[model samples]
Target: MYIVILNLTDKKADAPAHMADHNAWIAQGFEDGVFLVVGSLKPQGGGAILAVAEDITDLEARVAADPFVSKGIATPHIQQIAPARTDARLSFLKDVA
Candidate 1:
């Protein structure tokens, strides 16, 4: 799985314009079972998004085309996650055991 962290910089003001597109992407990701969850940082500083993908390349392409990235609303910091352990409620955890 990959975790994408977005930090808002120059285009914070453009958030509204890109919101619709952002939501659309998220919806599509959910339908495709790629996105896990997304939320903004406290005090509205920036945002964070978590996604599970087969590989980094696929995740990169998706992030590159994200509305926030496309519109320069936020810069993304992506990382590969290795889950040593997870709650039993997580779907991925089921596969692990």
Candidate 2:
């Protein structure tokens, strides 16, 4: 799994121009069964996406394709996590092993 952080490099006000494409990109992630969660970074600084991929390289390439990154509106920071434990409700994550 990966924690993908999108930190705004430009003004949040400039986001609207690329918002549609950005949203479409996110929607595609969900359709592809990669994105587990997607939401803002609080205070509206940017956004974050919880996703699953075969490897970090794949995830990085995926992140690179985001409109926010390609359009220079944001920078992506990706963290790879190997879950050793999880709540009962999230036991499914153990399958990633």
Best candidate, TM-score: 2
Off by over 4 Å in 1: 94-97
lDDT of 1 by residue, 1-97 (tens): 7678889987799898888999898788888877878888888677777788877888888888889888888899998777777776775743521
Alpha carbon lDDT at 49, candidate 1: 75
Write the residue-wise lDDT of candidate 2 on 7-95 in tens digits.
99955567899899999999999999999999998886899998999878888888999888988889999988889899999999878
Tell me which residue pairs clash in candidate 2: none
Output the number of the lDDT-best candidate: 2
Please give the lDDT score at residue 7 for candidate 1: 91
lDDT score at residue 82, model 2, on the 0-100 scale: 87
TM-score of 1: 0.86
| Each candidate structure's count of clashing pairs | 0, 0
The alpha-carbon root-mean-square deviation between model 2 and the true structure, to one decimal in Å, is 1.3
Q: Mark the 10 consecutive residues where model 2 has the least summed lDDT.
A: 9-18
